[model samples]
Target: MPRWIDTWMPGSGPEAPGGGYPGERLGLPAQGVSAVAGFGRRLAALTVDWLLGYGIAALFLGADVGTSPFAVLGVWFLLTAVPVAVFGSSAGMTALGIRVASVGSEPVVGVPRAVLRTALIALLVPPLVRDSDGRGWHDRAARTVVVRTRP
Candidate 1:
Protein backbone atom coordinates (compact mmCIF):
# COMPACT_ATOMS: atom_id res chain seq x y z
CA MET A 1 0.00 0.00 0.00
CA PRO A 2 3.06 2.28 0.26
CA ARG A 3 3.58 4.61 -2.70
CA TRP A 4 7.15 3.40 -3.11
CA ILE A 5 6.83 -0.32 -2.86
CA ASP A 6 10.44 -1.38 -3.13
CA THR A 7 9.88 -4.75 -4.73
CA TRP A 8 7.18 -6.74 -6.42
CA MET A 9 7.95 -10.10 -4.84
CA PRO A 10 6.68 -11.10 -1.40
CA GLY A 11 10.07 -11.13 0.40
CA SER A 12 12.26 -8.70 -1.53
CA GLY A 13 13.60 -6.62 1.35
CA PRO A 14 16.54 -4.20 1.06
CA GLU A 15 18.87 -6.83 2.44
CA ALA A 16 17.54 -9.75 0.46
CA PRO A 17 20.43 -12.09 -0.31
CA GLY A 18 19.46 -12.35 -3.97
CA GLY A 19 18.01 -9.36 -5.79
CA GLY A 20 14.40 -9.46 -6.98
CA TYR A 21 15.37 -9.86 -10.57
CA PRO A 22 18.36 -9.07 -12.72
CA GLY A 23 16.73 -6.56 -15.07
CA GLU A 24 13.98 -5.19 -12.81
CA ARG A 25 15.55 -1.76 -12.77
CA LEU A 26 15.51 -1.46 -16.52
CA GLY A 27 11.91 -0.34 -16.79
CA LEU A 28 12.08 0.02 -20.50
CA PRO A 29 8.67 -0.61 -22.04
CA ALA A 30 7.86 -2.78 -25.01
CA GLN A 31 8.24 0.15 -27.44
CA GLY A 32 4.99 -1.05 -28.97
CA VAL A 33 4.03 1.83 -31.22
CA SER A 34 7.45 2.04 -32.86
CA ALA A 35 7.81 -1.69 -33.18
CA VAL A 36 4.23 -2.26 -34.32
CA ALA A 37 5.11 -1.04 -37.78
CA GLY A 38 8.86 -1.42 -37.97
CA PHE A 39 10.66 -4.20 -39.82
CA GLY A 40 7.79 -5.17 -42.10
CA ARG A 41 7.05 -1.61 -43.04
CA ARG A 42 10.71 -0.75 -43.46
CA LEU A 43 11.35 -3.82 -45.59
CA ALA A 44 8.37 -3.05 -47.80
CA ALA A 45 9.56 0.50 -48.24
CA LEU A 46 13.07 -0.68 -49.13
CA THR A 47 11.60 -3.02 -51.72
CA VAL A 48 9.67 -0.19 -53.31
CA ASP A 49 12.75 2.01 -53.33
CA TRP A 50 14.83 -0.77 -54.88
CA LEU A 51 12.28 -1.27 -57.61
CA LEU A 52 12.31 2.41 -58.35
CA GLY A 53 16.10 2.49 -58.41
CA TYR A 54 16.31 -0.64 -60.54
CA GLY A 55 13.95 0.87 -63.04
CA ILE A 56 16.08 3.96 -63.25
CA ALA A 57 19.20 1.88 -63.65
CA ALA A 58 17.57 -0.11 -66.41
CA LEU A 59 16.84 3.08 -68.26
CA PHE A 60 20.39 4.36 -67.84
CA LEU A 61 22.28 1.12 -68.42
CA GLY A 62 20.01 -0.32 -71.11
CA ALA A 63 19.90 -4.01 -72.04
CA ASP A 64 23.62 -4.44 -72.56
CA VAL A 65 24.97 -2.93 -69.38
CA GLY A 66 28.66 -2.16 -69.25
CA THR A 67 31.06 -3.12 -66.46
CA SER A 68 31.96 0.27 -65.13
CA PRO A 69 31.60 0.49 -61.35
CA PHE A 70 31.36 4.23 -61.66
CA ALA A 71 28.31 3.86 -63.85
CA VAL A 72 26.66 1.62 -61.27
CA LEU A 73 27.50 4.10 -58.55
CA GLY A 74 26.15 6.89 -60.68
CA VAL A 75 22.89 5.07 -61.21
CA TRP A 76 22.47 4.36 -57.52
CA PHE A 77 23.40 7.93 -56.70
CA LEU A 78 20.70 9.24 -58.95
CA LEU A 79 18.23 6.76 -57.61
CA THR A 80 18.73 7.75 -53.98
CA ALA A 81 20.24 11.23 -53.74
CA VAL A 82 17.87 12.86 -56.23
CA PRO A 83 14.79 11.53 -54.52
CA VAL A 84 15.96 12.45 -51.03
CA ALA A 85 16.65 15.98 -52.18
CA VAL A 86 13.29 16.32 -53.90
CA PHE A 87 11.29 14.40 -51.31
CA GLY A 88 11.93 14.22 -47.58
CA SER A 89 11.31 10.51 -47.72
CA SER A 90 12.79 8.02 -50.15
CA ALA A 91 10.39 5.75 -52.02
CA GLY A 92 10.95 3.06 -49.42
CA MET A 93 10.56 5.38 -46.43
CA THR A 94 7.54 6.99 -48.04
CA ALA A 95 5.81 3.67 -48.45
CA LEU A 96 6.82 2.72 -44.93
CA GLY A 97 5.45 5.90 -43.33
CA ILE A 98 8.88 7.18 -42.39
CA ARG A 99 10.83 10.31 -43.24
CA VAL A 100 14.44 11.30 -42.84
CA ALA A 101 15.06 14.46 -40.87
CA SER A 102 18.07 16.08 -39.32
CA VAL A 103 18.78 14.54 -35.94
CA GLY A 104 18.64 17.81 -34.04
CA SER A 105 16.85 19.95 -36.60
CA GLU A 106 13.43 20.16 -38.13
CA PRO A 107 14.82 20.46 -41.65
CA VAL A 108 15.33 17.53 -43.98
CA VAL A 109 18.81 16.44 -44.99
CA GLY A 110 20.25 18.32 -47.98
CA VAL A 111 21.61 16.81 -51.18
CA PRO A 112 25.16 16.25 -49.92
CA ARG A 113 24.01 14.62 -46.68
CA ALA A 114 21.52 12.57 -48.59
CA VAL A 115 24.28 11.44 -50.95
CA LEU A 116 26.41 10.30 -48.03
CA ARG A 117 23.52 8.49 -46.43
CA THR A 118 22.55 6.86 -49.70
CA ALA A 119 26.09 5.78 -50.32
CA LEU A 120 26.24 4.10 -46.93
CA ILE A 121 22.94 2.38 -47.56
CA ALA A 122 23.97 1.23 -51.04
CA LEU A 123 27.05 -0.28 -49.46
CA LEU A 124 24.42 -2.55 -47.82
CA VAL A 125 26.11 -3.66 -44.61
CA PRO A 126 26.47 -0.17 -43.17
CA PRO A 127 22.75 0.42 -43.21
CA LEU A 128 21.98 -2.68 -41.20
CA VAL A 129 21.70 -1.33 -37.67
CA ARG A 130 20.02 -2.72 -34.58
CA ASP A 131 20.02 0.11 -32.13
CA SER A 132 17.45 0.40 -29.37
CA ASP A 133 16.06 3.47 -31.18
CA GLY A 134 15.88 1.50 -34.43
CA ARG A 135 18.23 3.75 -36.34
CA GLY A 136 20.64 2.42 -38.94
CA TRP A 137 24.30 3.41 -39.29
CA HIS A 138 23.43 5.35 -42.42
CA ASP A 139 20.99 7.33 -40.35
CA ARG A 140 23.72 8.05 -37.81
CA ALA A 141 26.28 8.77 -40.50
CA ALA A 142 24.15 11.48 -42.04
CA ARG A 143 23.23 13.06 -38.71
CA THR A 144 19.66 12.16 -39.61
CA VAL A 145 16.90 10.29 -37.94
CA VAL A 146 14.05 8.33 -39.46
CA VAL A 147 10.70 8.96 -37.87
CA ARG A 148 7.43 7.17 -38.45
CA THR A 149 5.05 9.71 -39.90
CA ARG A 150 1.43 10.03 -38.92
CA PRO A 151 -0.95 9.81 -41.87
Candidate 2:
Protein backbone atom coordinates (compact mmCIF):
# COMPACT_ATOMS: atom_id res chain seq x y z
CA MET A 1 0.00 0.00 0.00
CA PRO A 2 1.16 3.54 -0.60
CA ARG A 3 0.52 4.51 3.00
CA TRP A 4 2.34 1.45 4.28
CA ILE A 5 5.30 2.10 2.01
CA ASP A 6 5.46 5.73 3.07
CA THR A 7 5.34 4.75 6.72
CA TRP A 8 7.91 2.03 6.27
CA MET A 9 10.33 4.22 4.42
CA PRO A 10 11.45 7.35 6.17
CA GLY A 11 12.31 10.56 4.26
CA SER A 12 9.45 9.75 1.85
CA GLY A 13 6.96 12.30 3.10
CA PRO A 14 6.13 15.54 1.39
CA GLU A 15 9.22 17.49 0.47
CA ALA A 16 10.08 19.97 3.16
CA PRO A 17 13.17 21.68 4.48
CA GLY A 18 14.73 19.50 7.17
CA GLY A 19 16.15 22.61 8.82
CA GLY A 20 19.53 23.97 7.80
CA TYR A 21 22.65 22.38 6.37
CA PRO A 22 24.74 19.78 8.13
CA GLY A 23 26.42 20.99 11.38
CA GLU A 24 24.09 23.97 11.55
CA ARG A 25 22.19 22.19 14.30
CA LEU A 26 25.43 22.10 16.27
CA GLY A 27 25.99 25.81 15.74
CA LEU A 28 29.01 25.23 13.54
CA PRO A 29 29.87 27.83 10.96
CA ALA A 30 28.84 27.36 7.34
CA GLN A 31 32.44 27.58 6.16
CA GLY A 32 36.01 28.29 7.27
CA VAL A 33 37.62 27.19 10.52
CA SER A 34 35.29 25.40 12.99
CA ALA A 35 33.14 24.16 10.14
CA VAL A 36 32.34 20.46 10.08
CA ALA A 37 34.71 18.39 7.97
CA GLY A 38 33.22 16.66 4.93
CA PHE A 39 33.27 12.93 4.12
CA GLY A 40 36.13 13.19 1.62
CA ARG A 41 38.35 15.00 4.09
CA ARG A 42 37.55 12.54 6.84
CA LEU A 43 38.17 9.57 4.54
CA ALA A 44 41.46 11.03 3.40
CA ALA A 45 42.57 11.58 6.98
CA LEU A 46 41.65 8.00 7.87
CA THR A 47 43.54 6.68 4.87
CA VAL A 48 46.65 8.56 5.90
CA ASP A 49 46.44 7.34 9.47
CA TRP A 50 45.86 3.75 8.37
CA LEU A 51 48.82 3.86 6.00
CA LEU A 52 51.02 5.33 8.69
CA GLY A 53 49.96 2.63 11.11
CA TYR A 54 50.57 -0.09 8.55
CA GLY A 55 54.00 1.31 7.85
CA ILE A 56 54.85 1.39 11.53
CA ALA A 57 53.75 -2.19 12.02
CA ALA A 58 55.62 -3.31 8.95
CA LEU A 59 58.76 -1.57 10.11
CA PHE A 60 58.71 -2.88 13.65
CA LEU A 61 57.40 -6.38 13.10
CA GLY A 62 58.50 -6.94 9.52
CA ALA A 63 56.79 -9.94 7.90
CA ASP A 64 55.12 -10.81 11.20
CA VAL A 65 52.50 -8.15 10.49
CA GLY A 66 51.20 -10.28 7.65
CA THR A 67 50.43 -13.02 10.14
CA SER A 68 49.07 -10.82 12.95
CA PRO A 69 46.41 -8.25 12.31
CA PHE A 70 46.47 -7.31 15.99
CA ALA A 71 49.84 -5.71 15.53
CA VAL A 72 48.52 -3.40 12.86
CA LEU A 73 45.42 -2.69 14.94
CA GLY A 74 47.51 -1.86 17.98
CA VAL A 75 49.67 0.50 16.00
CA TRP A 76 46.63 2.10 14.46
CA PHE A 77 45.03 2.59 17.85
CA LEU A 78 48.14 4.24 19.18
CA LEU A 79 48.47 6.40 16.10
CA THR A 80 44.87 7.56 16.40
CA ALA A 81 44.60 7.90 20.18
CA VAL A 82 47.84 9.49 21.30
CA PRO A 83 47.86 12.56 19.11
CA VAL A 84 44.13 13.09 19.50
CA ALA A 85 44.53 12.97 23.26
CA VAL A 86 47.44 15.41 23.33
CA PHE A 87 47.09 17.56 20.22
CA GLY A 88 43.44 17.04 19.19
CA SER A 89 44.61 15.77 15.80
CA SER A 90 46.64 12.91 14.39
CA ALA A 91 49.34 13.27 11.75
CA GLY A 92 46.78 12.71 9.01
CA MET A 93 44.19 15.04 10.48
CA THR A 94 46.81 17.72 10.93
CA ALA A 95 47.95 17.34 7.35
CA LEU A 96 44.34 17.47 6.17
CA GLY A 97 43.74 20.70 8.11
CA ILE A 98 41.19 19.14 10.40
CA ARG A 99 41.13 18.55 14.13
CA VAL A 100 38.88 16.80 16.58
CA ALA A 101 37.38 18.96 19.28
CA SER A 102 35.12 18.33 22.21
CA VAL A 103 31.60 19.73 22.06
CA GLY A 104 32.59 21.85 25.02
CA SER A 105 35.63 24.05 25.58
CA GLU A 106 38.24 21.41 26.32
CA PRO A 107 41.42 21.99 24.36
CA VAL A 108 42.33 18.33 24.24
CA VAL A 109 39.99 15.31 24.26
CA GLY A 110 42.04 13.61 27.00
CA VAL A 111 43.01 9.94 27.19
CA PRO A 112 39.72 8.27 28.11
CA ARG A 113 37.59 9.88 25.41
CA ALA A 114 40.32 9.53 22.83
CA VAL A 115 40.76 5.86 23.65
CA LEU A 116 37.04 5.19 23.51
CA ARG A 117 36.72 7.01 20.23
CA THR A 118 39.63 5.17 18.70
CA ALA A 119 38.31 1.84 19.84
CA LEU A 120 34.91 2.49 18.28
CA ILE A 121 36.57 3.66 15.10
CA ALA A 122 38.58 0.46 15.00
CA LEU A 123 35.32 -1.48 14.96
CA LEU A 124 34.75 0.09 11.51
CA VAL A 125 30.95 -0.01 11.65
CA PRO A 126 30.62 2.83 14.12
CA PRO A 127 32.62 5.19 11.99
CA LEU A 128 30.46 4.38 8.96
CA VAL A 129 27.18 5.08 10.70
CA ARG A 130 26.52 8.80 10.53
CA ASP A 131 23.64 10.87 11.79
CA SER A 132 21.66 13.64 10.14
CA ASP A 133 24.35 16.02 11.29
CA GLY A 134 27.01 13.87 9.64
CA ARG A 135 28.60 12.88 12.95
CA GLY A 136 29.70 9.27 13.15
CA TRP A 137 28.64 7.03 16.04
CA HIS A 138 32.19 7.02 17.37
CA ASP A 139 32.30 10.78 17.53
CA ARG A 140 28.82 10.99 19.02
CA ALA A 141 29.68 8.49 21.72
CA ALA A 142 32.86 10.36 22.57
CA ARG A 143 31.16 13.76 22.40
CA THR A 144 33.70 15.03 19.92
CA VAL A 145 33.56 16.52 16.43
CA VAL A 146 35.99 16.90 13.56
CA VAL A 147 36.23 20.46 12.31
CA ARG A 148 38.25 22.24 9.71
CA THR A 149 41.27 24.22 10.90
CA ARG A 150 41.76 26.55 7.96
CA PRO A 151 39.55 28.60 5.72
Candidate 3:
Protein backbone atom coordinates (compact mmCIF):
# COMPACT_ATOMS: atom_id res chain seq x y z
CA MET A 1 0.00 0.00 0.00
CA PRO A 2 1.20 3.52 -0.80
CA ARG A 3 1.64 6.08 1.95
CA TRP A 4 -1.18 8.59 2.39
CA ILE A 5 1.19 11.49 1.66
CA ASP A 6 2.23 9.86 -1.59
CA THR A 7 -1.39 9.37 -2.56
CA TRP A 8 -2.54 12.92 -1.81
CA MET A 9 0.49 15.13 -2.35
CA PRO A 10 1.58 16.02 -5.80
CA GLY A 11 5.24 15.37 -6.74
CA SER A 12 5.62 13.11 -3.75
CA GLY A 13 5.92 9.74 -5.47
CA PRO A 14 9.09 8.44 -7.08
CA GLU A 15 7.58 8.85 -10.50
CA ALA A 16 6.72 12.46 -9.81
CA PRO A 17 9.42 15.05 -10.27
CA GLY A 18 8.89 18.10 -8.05
CA GLY A 19 9.01 21.06 -10.42
CA GLY A 20 9.65 23.63 -7.69
CA TYR A 21 7.68 26.17 -5.67
CA PRO A 22 4.16 27.48 -6.39
CA GLY A 23 4.69 29.71 -9.44
CA GLU A 24 7.67 27.80 -10.80
CA ARG A 25 5.46 25.70 -13.08
CA LEU A 26 4.45 28.95 -14.74
CA GLY A 27 8.12 29.87 -15.25
CA LEU A 28 8.19 32.40 -12.48
CA PRO A 29 11.18 32.83 -10.20
CA ALA A 30 11.11 30.81 -7.01
CA GLN A 31 11.89 33.83 -4.84
CA GLY A 32 12.52 37.58 -4.79
CA VAL A 33 11.14 40.02 -7.35
CA SER A 34 8.99 38.46 -10.07
CA ALA A 35 7.90 35.66 -7.80
CA VAL A 36 4.20 34.97 -7.37
CA ALA A 37 2.55 37.35 -4.95
CA GLY A 38 1.53 35.61 -1.77
CA PHE A 39 -1.82 35.79 0.01
CA GLY A 40 -0.81 38.49 2.47
CA ARG A 41 0.51 40.79 -0.23
CA ARG A 42 -2.55 40.20 -2.39
CA LEU A 43 -4.83 40.95 0.56
CA ALA A 44 -2.96 44.11 1.35
CA ALA A 45 -3.23 45.29 -2.23
CA LEU A 46 -6.96 44.55 -2.18
CA THR A 47 -7.45 46.50 1.02
CA VAL A 48 -5.63 49.45 -0.44
CA ASP A 49 -7.70 49.37 -3.59
CA TRP A 50 -10.97 49.05 -1.66
CA LEU A 51 -10.10 52.00 0.51
CA LEU A 52 -9.27 54.06 -2.56
CA GLY A 53 -12.54 53.06 -4.22
CA TYR A 54 -14.50 53.96 -1.13
CA GLY A 55 -12.78 57.30 -0.97
CA ILE A 56 -13.45 58.10 -4.61
CA ALA A 57 -17.11 57.11 -4.34
CA ALA A 58 -17.55 59.12 -1.18
CA LEU A 59 -15.86 62.19 -2.54
CA PHE A 60 -16.93 62.37 -6.17
CA LEU A 61 -20.26 60.59 -6.14
CA GLY A 62 -21.12 62.23 -2.82
CA ALA A 63 -22.40 58.90 -1.63
CA ASP A 64 -21.79 57.35 1.73
CA VAL A 65 -19.88 54.28 0.66
CA GLY A 66 -21.07 52.54 3.79
CA THR A 67 -24.61 52.86 2.44
CA SER A 68 -23.91 52.86 -1.33
CA PRO A 69 -22.45 49.54 -2.33
CA PHE A 70 -22.89 49.89 -6.08
CA ALA A 71 -21.06 53.20 -6.28
CA VAL A 72 -18.11 51.78 -4.42
CA LEU A 73 -18.06 48.67 -6.57
CA GLY A 74 -18.10 50.77 -9.72
CA VAL A 75 -15.19 52.82 -8.54
CA TRP A 76 -13.38 49.71 -7.51
CA PHE A 77 -13.92 48.10 -10.90
CA LEU A 78 -12.61 51.15 -12.71
CA LEU A 79 -9.61 51.40 -10.45
CA THR A 80 -8.75 47.76 -10.94
CA ALA A 81 -9.56 47.18 -14.60
CA VAL A 82 -8.29 50.32 -16.29
CA PRO A 83 -4.91 50.42 -14.62
CA VAL A 84 -4.32 46.71 -14.95
CA ALA A 85 -5.12 47.00 -18.65
CA VAL A 86 -2.82 49.87 -19.38
CA PHE A 87 -0.15 49.73 -16.71
CA GLY A 88 -0.26 46.08 -15.64
CA SER A 89 -1.16 47.11 -12.12
CA SER A 90 -3.48 49.37 -10.12
CA ALA A 91 -2.32 52.10 -7.76
CA GLY A 92 -2.75 49.70 -4.88
CA MET A 93 -0.82 47.00 -6.69
CA THR A 94 1.90 49.43 -7.54
CA ALA A 95 2.15 50.61 -3.99
CA LEU A 96 2.31 47.03 -2.82
CA GLY A 97 4.93 46.16 -5.45
CA ILE A 98 2.86 43.70 -7.42
CA ARG A 99 1.65 43.51 -11.02
CA VAL A 100 -0.66 41.46 -13.24
CA ALA A 101 0.85 39.86 -16.30
CA SER A 102 -0.19 37.46 -19.00
CA VAL A 103 0.54 33.81 -18.41
CA GLY A 104 1.56 33.58 -22.05
CA SER A 105 4.55 35.12 -23.82
CA GLU A 106 3.15 38.62 -23.59
CA PRO A 107 4.34 40.80 -20.75
CA VAL A 108 1.16 42.82 -20.40
CA VAL A 109 -2.44 41.86 -19.81
CA GLY A 110 -4.72 43.46 -22.39
CA VAL A 111 -7.91 45.40 -21.66
CA PRO A 112 -10.28 42.56 -22.49
CA ARG A 113 -8.53 40.15 -20.19
CA ALA A 114 -8.31 42.78 -17.47
CA VAL A 115 -12.00 43.52 -17.75
CA LEU A 116 -12.94 39.86 -17.60
CA ARG A 117 -10.66 39.28 -14.66
CA THR A 118 -12.06 42.29 -12.86
CA ALA A 119 -15.62 41.16 -13.50
CA LEU A 120 -14.97 37.72 -12.11
CA ILE A 121 -13.20 39.23 -9.12
CA ALA A 122 -16.23 41.45 -8.53
CA LEU A 123 -18.33 38.29 -8.22
CA LEU A 124 -16.19 37.51 -5.13
CA VAL A 125 -16.37 33.71 -5.18
CA PRO A 126 -14.05 33.36 -8.15
CA PRO A 127 -11.18 35.10 -6.44
CA LEU A 128 -11.66 32.99 -3.34
CA VAL A 129 -11.24 29.75 -5.24
CA ARG A 130 -7.50 29.39 -5.68
CA ASP A 131 -5.63 26.66 -7.52
CA SER A 132 -2.68 24.77 -6.05
CA ASP A 133 -0.40 27.48 -7.38
CA GLY A 134 -2.46 30.19 -5.67
CA ARG A 135 -3.97 31.51 -8.85
CA GLY A 136 -7.61 32.45 -8.39
CA TRP A 137 -10.31 31.40 -10.83
CA HIS A 138 -10.47 34.98 -12.07
CA ASP A 139 -6.78 34.79 -12.97
CA ARG A 140 -7.09 31.39 -14.66
CA ALA A 141 -10.08 32.54 -16.65
CA ALA A 142 -8.17 35.59 -17.80
CA ARG A 143 -4.87 33.76 -18.27
CA THR A 144 -3.15 36.27 -16.00
CA VAL A 145 -1.06 36.07 -12.87
CA VAL A 146 -0.03 38.48 -10.16
CA VAL A 147 3.67 38.70 -9.41
CA ARG A 148 5.88 40.64 -7.06
CA THR A 149 7.57 43.63 -8.63
CA ARG A 150 10.41 43.85 -6.17
CA PRO A 151 12.47 41.68 -3.92
Best by TM-score: 2
Q: Which stretches of candidate 3 lie over 4 Å from their true place?
A: 1-19
- Give the clashing pairs for model 3: none
How does each model score on lDDT?
Answer: 0.60, 0.85, 0.84
lDDT of 2 by residue, 1-151 (tens): 3574442122443322665766786789879999999989999999999999999999999988889889989998999999999999999999999999898778789999999999999999887877656678788778888999987
Model 2 alpha-carbon drift over 4 Å, by segment: 1-17
Q: Rank the candidates by TM-score, best first.
A: 2, 3, 1
In candidate 3, how many Å is residue 149 off?
Answer: 0.4
Clashing pairs in 2: none
TM-scores of the models, in the given order?
Answer: 0.64, 0.86, 0.85
TM-score of 3: 0.85
Superposed by TM-score, candidate 1 places the C-alpha of residue 85 at a distance from the truth, in angstroms, of 3.1
lDDT computed for candidate 1: 0.60
What are the per-residue Cα lDDT tens digits for candidate 1 across 44-136? 777787766566766777864445556655665676687786676877777677767665544668888888888888787765653434546
lDDT, candidate 2, at 95: 95
Weakest ten-residue segment in model 3 by summed lDDT: 7-16
